[model samples]
Target: MGYFVPVEPGVNLFVEDINQEGSKTIVFIHGWPLSHKQFEYQFNILPALGYRCIGIDWRGFGKSDKPISGYTYNRLADDIRMIVSTLQLDNFSLVGHSTGGAIAIRYMSRYSGYGVSKLVLIDAAAPTGFTKETAKDLLKETLNDRPKMMQGITDTFFFQYITSSFSDWFFQMGLEAAGWSTAAIIKLLRDEKLDADLPKIDKPTLIIHGIHDKVIPFAQAQELDQKIRNSQLVPFQYSGHGPFWEERDKVNQLLTQFI
Candidate 1:
């Protein structure tokens, strides 16, 4: 796919360019600890449905130039803006998940791109009073032993995503998916708070959350649904934070409707 979009100096905004001639653009933003790779199902499936899907890898993740700094929501938002402007994209949609959702919201609140028309939050992350309090305490225990912490997060971060096929392969996969320092990851945990910016959003919004989401929980999704004025919440009966990953067919179907 010719993925090329630089967010800023020293911060490479990673992108998976699906089409240049498609009618409308649907940019996919990935979550913390995951890069554009997370949108594999959508990137490959949605284009068949006549939607241009471009998944972006934030500076510290994916194929982008991962500098030591520039992992905050503000910096990440700037990276997204750069991708949009650099590509000259218009009348587009943004599907962001987890931390990526927070990044999209930051972009919407700050920079309304030339043609960004719709926004979808797939278990999207928002401040709405959600905190990385869990991460904070967890970080303390694992700061001195990242590999041990990474081992512990194998399931918590990915659910029953563990397996013999991937086996220990998925271990490092989780670690480098979105390259970030402990401080940066902790910073993202804190950035999930969006109370000050949700009301300012002006685009049509779709909030999809799994009923069984243990990572972000359903209440946060409910709070997001209640807060976003033009937003609608779609409950996935059996899934977690990465419903799109767990249920691509369903997620793509709803995305088709939403976009």
Candidate 2:
């Protein structure tokens, strides 16, 4: 089932909830320039395995409300808190990818890991550092020619072969997002640091990172594994930045066993 859940005044996030009566619940937060749709592969399998899969389309992406403001990690995490509260979700596994991983980290810290039992970060972008110049150039490119920028991301997003039609579908997902929101998130990625938040996560965490990930270096995952106590790092050797799709079967199996 899918519906809009209010996060703030005039701001409602699109949520896809499946297998509502499943024994276990897993909440998915997608990365930048994408939506809940990013986890289509996982959603297809997890639900059938008796896992309640909940995916949230961040505001300004997917079918969620698009506002010019509130792109910061704090507000983004707060939006998730509202969803958890409204749904009365507890003892659930939280999964996040890319930028969604960073937001998940913020959620863990800001909300004290409320109602979450296990944490899964897939090719997460946290404990990262980027120069201001790089951020500025990326933002400029994003605003000036988003198609080219998105194409570049799509080109480097995967290590495995993706069909032309599949590539087009992925590219279209980026286009569906508001341009301003996209740029705002770029700034957030550049500016925000989750060094302090890492140690605060007390849940049993699983960090799944692709060894060949170019977007967020493999070292960041190493840092996350070292800092987050009781965390295990699983490297996806045959994947790039998107192991959840590039190696869906392994990811699903790992998630099933872990969660």
lDDT of 2: 0.94
Q: Which candidate ranks first by TM-score, i.e. highest? A: 2
Ten contiguous residues minimizing lDDT sum, candidate 2? 127-136
Put down candidate 1 lDDT per residue, 99-165, tens digits, no spaces. 7888888888878533679989877767642356766765664466666666665566444364755
Give the CA lDDT, 0 to 100, for residue 152 in model 2: 88
What lDDT does candidate 2 reach at residue 217?
A: 90
The alpha-carbon deviation from the true structure for residue 79 of candidate 1, after best TM-score superposition, in angstroms, is 0.8
Which RMSD values do the candidates have, in order?
A: 2.5, 0.9
User: Model 2 over residues 1-259: C-alpha lDDT tens digits?
Assistant: 9999999999999999999999999999999899999999999999999999999999999999999999998999999999999999999999999999999999999999999999999988897645588678779889999998889889999988999999999999998899999999998988889999998999999999999998889999999999999999999999999999999999999999999
Q: After superposing candidate 2, which stretches have Cα over 4 Å from the reference?
A: none
